[model samples]
Target chain A: MTAFLIENKYTVGIMLGVIFGLASRILMLRTDYRQYPTYPHGRIIHISLGVIAAALGAVAVPALFNKDYTAITFLTLAAQQFRDVRKMERDTLTKIDELELVQRGTTYIEGIAMVFEGRNYLVIMTAFFSSLFAISFTWYYGLAAGIVSMIIVLALRSGKSISHIASAESVPVKQDGPDLLVGDIYIMNVGLKVNQELIAERGLGVIIKPYNPNGKATLSNLGQRQAILYDLSTILGVYRDDGEPALIPMAKLDMRDGRLAIFLLPQEKNASKAREIVLRVPILESAVRMPTEAKVNQQEGS
Target chain B: MGEIKAVVTMHKQQVGGGAPIFVADNVKQMEETAFLLEKLLDAAVHDLKNGTFILVKHK
Candidate 1:
């Protein structure tokens, strides 16, 4: 090796190439494998390819710097590794999501690689390969570098297409909307902060009413209005002690995040005139599946 | 327990010929309770689809 370096001073550059190639491969193996480990078989393929790539770069890069190589075996090996890495990507998605190719699948490996960006893998491979090219033609290394850079640019665009397909294959999307039954909902008070408020009930004295100081308050000692709850679907019908109905529209209804909250007031009150009326909203039974489906029916224009 | 920020309870109902039950809870417990229910439903649906729903006893 010393004799070879003495014969050609450029051989020193080949050492740098070998060092960079091995470093890139080690970095990729250490970081990338964890992101997609479901396909242990694919992991083996990628690692072996990286090893072969680094080894080929080690020999070819120095030989090329020394202006040797009876046959461009290292270049050929590097290309083969890149090609295999590209092919391994498809094997990762062996688990079929759906018959239509757009449904969700639990054990999707290709989708995982796509999420991490396949082109980045290619760019890393090309960076390793570039060291070999640098050894071959010291003057034309600039041109070789530009060519690989173009491939990286092109791979990025292809990665986007892969991402679209992979995302469609991986994500579990439901077609139907959420099951929301709004009625007979009673609000229960889970104690929040309380404050004193002057109460005036027509002829009644200035009795102090326990008011929840923050809007983040729950109803206290509340029981469900059974007759109303059983029949309710979306609208909460608030009634006074005398059974007089007050219209309350549910402002937010989500069971997973919390129980539904309804803003109630008289039907005659407009936006400016509406007074704050809080009611015990009914606790939603968590039987309904696909809660996120509710947002699908909402106005898209908003 | 400090100041009683919230209290939640589940309401169970038997339905669909099996002892498949539904849980009702207040807002504080709604989110987590619903997620658990969704998981249960997923298993139930999988069982029903595969004709294994009969093999498992009700909880």
Candidate 2:
């Protein structure tokens, strides 16, 4: 048994590597409340790529053992290939967003694309580690290594949500004549009395207060604001149709205090649920600005 | 993000335009005309508060 294991160590190591790599990819590919990657077709495309990534990672160790120096070039080629995947995701998502009622803004789409590309790299890393451990020690060590890498990858997958940087609460959606206000922050003008009444009846308002200058700067980004609205509407269901501009959701800044006020007309008018959703909105990576980190502001921030 | 596509006003004297305009006889007539324009145009009505309602199409 030991002789057989020693003779086919590379084969067993590669199998373990591919298995772990594919598992991580499948685990990361979730079509949850976000409903991203769009079911069967999208799932198939990503999974096929995962297989290729896994194979590349697994074979690298054997190639190095054979002293085949040219094999390192494949990894570089894979990086280029993965980058194209990011571009493909971005282009497709941007095109789809144009037709959405509550569009997933560019920041959100870019984040998703980055996530996809990052996950592929993670799979490669996991496969490499698992294969390395398998060939260097035993197949059992490879399993342990795979599990450890999977945990780390999953842990790193999620970034900060709104609650991490700010506090969110339900506020009243009020109107002073023609002006729509989320608390004291004016959202927009509602000209028609009928539409105003509808908004009054159906509108859900939220106020988000940032904890620091960094949070404030992030929230102030238009892309981030649009992402917040997009997520809120997708989960809570927007009470709007195409060309019905009066029923549109809006987020406005209270420039004085760096507070944000959001006014939404959701199909479901549950305040607590809306508040929960607001807190859970993923902070966009591009929108995150650490203004306090600047040398000029560091002294004051500290 | 929005462009005023049409204007419905009680005071014909209040507005002039690059966009189309509809003049109404009274407040009730102005409201009715604006409401019709809002539905027909599938736009938002914004009260200028000078007896004018502008129908805006938000893209």
Candidate 3:
């Protein structure tokens, strides 16, 4: 039993480091420090320092048996790795947020994108864990595990992040001009769930019917009225006389799946004309006769 | 995964005009690295504003 423990000390230590690394990442992410510098930075620094502690733990666990300078060397390397991870996480978030904010306001989607950032931490985590593995155990095993974990985490986080962002329901701008550009912004809440393929594949289409008192402004009337839809690409067509406007804004067209619906609206103030539609109430068909109020009242009485 | 070494935004030109870029790397650098990064990013942003940058990424 004692022998088994001795042999497995390094393995145990590496596992512990993995667990510690995961926890630290989560904590650092949760405690965003840039805004509340004192409080956030304190928490982040603690975690950053904790990473070194974790590396020491890895080295010490094996050192109990090996009792060599090798463990000491690894401890040094791991400490550096930990420091790198901490700095990366902090710097990336800070720089990205600064640039994004300069480009767009907090209310814009750019703020959310800039703020809810990741990727750097993920890469560092993979490297740190793998290094721990290689130093503690076989290099190949460590590399394999580290690579696998990194890929999995990246995939998972991407989906998760994307969905989270999407739920926020706004386009994050990294560059600025206007918030309401004449383009369809693909929304993904977390990294996992994305509407890119769906939006691109299906395209926008009329779903909600526009209101018209005489019922003359249905999508079919596009032949009679003028309408246009533009984007990175262009789609232009005239209304076919069915009450649908002649030009449907590409943004208004959406994939037919139950997931999304598309429709047109009048150009909102400040929005680009090429991208935005100016919704207009349709004039009543000249041929349609209106019933007299007296007749309607009589029908209601009966 | 190690922490991100650096997160740099780049710019890439598309058919229509151009767009700002995002480039992330995991390599460590010396003190001058930060200054170099700033220069690169600033240049990219300039291109984005001017509609000239075609593509930018971590080499």
Candidate 4:
């Protein structure tokens, strides 16, 4: 078996590379509470793309070894294909969001799309490095490299959640006359007496206090706030249905201190669990702002 | 900001614009009209605290 492997080294190397690449892709493709990528169909589409990405990455190794330099340009072509994948994800998610009771805001959708694009590149890297090791060194070395790279890539992919930046505390849903408030932060004006009563009785609220200016900037992003509302509604189940805009969930910022107050009318009404969910909400990449890292802020601590 | 779909007010003289305006005879009638408009138009009712409620379709 070892003698035959040496004879057909390129084939064995490519096959192993493809396997590792596909494995990395599969590991990255997760169906969490978001239920995004749908079910069987979404999985199929991504897996097929993964296979293609793996093949492209694996082939480039042998191509480079054979002095077929022109083949490297195919990686660029593969990049174009992945860009289309991002666009496809964005378009699909945006259309689906319109029908959602709590829509995933554009920033969240963009982050998801970016993840799809980035994962493909990670798969390529995994395949390329694995194939290079297999062709240059040994199959066992290639396997080791593949495993190490997969761990590293996944670590990069697993970004921080809201809890890393801010702390979420359960707060009372209050109404001061017509103004609906979550703690001291005024959310909105509840016009109808019936709606106000329903909110006061069944509503849940949370106060998200950012640890620093960076978290504050991120929390204040409209898209980030919408993402929080979307996740809360999805997990806890929103009380309102079609044509009930008055009972919709909202995250209002306390301009005085950049504190976020979320008002939700959940079907389950579990305040502690809801606060946990708020803390665990994925921070959108686009929404992440590092104002403290700026030159002016660093210079004088202003 | 959202488009004001309609207005339900006890005093018609207070509001005037391109959007449709609904005038009610009293406080009870104004609340009832605002609630109905909210459901029908799929909009949020915001109280002006002066017996005027604006139904806004928040996009």
Candidate 5:
């Protein structure tokens, strides 16, 4: 048995690479608070794709060793397949967003889809690297490379949040007659006196102050603002049900100063937690705007 | 979606049951009201293909 293993070390290397690649994919796959990639079925689909990715990655090294250069083309095909996975996720999420109480905007949906697609490439890289190291050096080197790749995968899992760019503070939710205001930012008019009273009693307000021009520009995007509201509603629990127009959480920009004022009636009235959620809201890739970096803005600044 | 037909009406008195009540005299005013509703109430204006815009707010 030991002699057989020694003679066919490349085969053993490929097997180990496939295992590590699958492990990396499994490690990255999680159904979190959002309940995305939902239980059994959703998870099964992704896992099956991960297995295919792992197999493809593992076989490439052996194929290359035997001078089968055409095996490299399979990687391109795998990439196209992964892009389709991204499209599937986007289409699914867009359809689901239509039914959400607080909809994740297009920017957020796109960001999620992009991440899903990118992670598959990471899986392929992890498998390819492990296979390469094992075939070129030793089996132990492959194990080391796999571990390192897994760490890289873990590090790249999540993107930066709003807190990285701005600061969020709890503010007073003030009512004057029918006008609902969050820190002088007019939220809405609660025509019903009873609803006004409920808002006065239960509403939580937050003001997000951007630290720099970049943050300010990002906050200006309607999609980013909507993303903030969605994240807040998702985490803290929206106070209102479907068709209750008055109770919908809103994020409005203080157009003059670029400050964002958010008004929400939360099931959980913890102001600090709400603020934390606001700060932790991921900045949507599509909604990110860097006016500060633009030549026109720079010229005006100087 | 076709070119949006302009039909603007303004309501001075408050409507009942927490439903959004918009009052505007012209297209500009209607747009302003719609903007306020969007920012303040998080309502979306959907064109119904019947030459009318329905402002719907999702919780």
Candidate 6:
């Protein structure tokens, strides 16, 4: 039994590598509160792709040992395929965003699509390294390498959230006649008496105060503000039904101080939960603006 | 559908070429014009600060 194990070491290595690679992909693929990569169909699609990626990674080392140079071409093909996957995700999310009360802007959608594409590449790298270690040394070595790679993957699982860049505070929702204000920042005008009454009764307000110039600039972006609104509405569940645009969640910028005021009539009506959601909202990569790093700003500072 | 009781007017001060739309003299007139537009053309009102409100058709 020991002799047989030693004889087919490469085969054992390949199998272990493939298993590790698949495990890493599975660990990373998650459909959280957002319900993205939707249920059975979405999970199946990603799993299938992960299998292909794992297979490619596991097979590459053996193919190289056999001197089959053509195997390298498959990696290139896989790269192209993953790029297409990113595009598919972007298109689907964009279409879905249109139907949303507070749309996830193009920037946020693109960031999410990019994340999906990048994750596949990470899977490929993990599998490739695990297989390489196994083929060069032993199956045990490959397992160790796989574990280390998985840790790295886990470490980089997600990006920074809004709380990292700004502080969110629960603010007073005031109705001055027909105008709605979130901590002195004008949100909207409720021309209808009924709408005014509804807002006065149920509306909750939050003010996001940016930590620095960069944070301030990011909050100023319409897309970033919309992303905040979309996330808040998605988690808390919007108060209004379809066609009731009057009760839609809104995030408005305070032009004078760069603070963002968000107003929403949530079904949950939990102020602490809403504030937590805003704080934990992932900062969209595309919406991040660095005014402090700009050349003009540097020159002015000098 | 509800009665158009209040209105908000928007003034576009930019480089453009189009027929002059209704211009309101005061807040009351603006509210009346906005209400009329809301009823005549089924649109949702969005406030874009500085006394401007955009009336867009809801999808």
TM-score of chain B of each: 0.28, 0.92, 0.22, 0.92, 0.49, 0.58
Q: Give Cα distance to truth, residue B27, candidate 2, Å.
A: 1.8
> What pairs collide in candidate 5?
A101-B59, B9-B24, B10-B23, B10-B24, B11-B23
Per-residue lDDT of model 2, residues A159-270, tens digit only = 8999999999899999899999998999999998888899889998999999998999999999999999999999999999976778889999999999999999999899
* Highest-scoring model, lDDT: 4
Alpha carbon lDDT of each predicted model: 0.32, 0.91, 0.35, 0.92, 0.80, 0.81
Q: Is candidate 1 or candidate 4 better by TM-score?
A: 4
TM-score of each: 0.30, 0.97, 0.24, 0.96, 0.82, 0.84
Stretches of candidate 3 off by over 4 Å are A1-116, A160-261, A264-302, B1-59
Ranking by TM-score: 2, 4, 6, 5, 1, 3
Report the lDDT tens digits of candidate 6 across residue range A1-302: 75665578788777877788789889988988888889989988988888888888888888888899998898999899999999999999999987877678898889889988888888887888888888788777888899998999999888889999999998879998767899989987766456678888899999999999999988888888888888888898888865665787888989888899999998788888989999998888888889989999999999
Q: Which scores greater on TM-score, model 5 or model 6?
A: 6
Model 6 alpha-carbon drift over 4 Å, by segment: A294-302, B1-42, B45-59
Compare candidates 1 and 6 on lDDT and give the better one. Answer: 6
Model 2's CAPRI class? medium
lDDT of 5 by residue, A1-302 (tens): 75665677789778878888899999999987778898989999988899889888888998899899998899999999999999999999999999998888888889889988888888888898898898887787888999999999999887788998899999999987667899989876654444677899999999999988899999888888888888888788888876466677888888888899999988899999999898888888887878788999899999
Cα RMSD, each candidate: 20.5, 1.4, 24.4, 1.6, 7.4, 5.5
B19-56: candidate 3 lDDT, tens digit per residue: 33334232222213333543444311112222222222
For every model in order, what is the number of clashing pairs? 17, 0, 64, 0, 5, 0
The TM-scores of chain A alone, one per candidate, are 0.32, 0.97, 0.26, 0.98, 0.94, 0.94
Candidate 5 CAPRI assessment class: incorrect
Clashing pairs in 4: none
**Tens digit of per-residue lDDT, candidate 3, span A200-299:** 3223332222222222222322321221121111122222122121112223222232121222222221223212222221121222222333577569
Indicate which candidate wins on TM-score: 2
| Model 1 quality (TM-score) | 0.30
Give the alpha carbon lDDT tens digit for every residue of A1-302 in model 4: 98877777788889988999999999999888899777989999999999999999999999999999998999999999999999999999999999998889899999999999999999999998898898888887888889998998889878889999999999999888889888899889889999999998899999999999999999999999999999999999999898999898999999989999999999999999999999999999999999989899899975
In model 2, state the lDDT of residue A50.
Answer: 96
- State the DockQ of every prediction: 0.04, 0.78, 0.01, 0.86, 0.07, 0.17
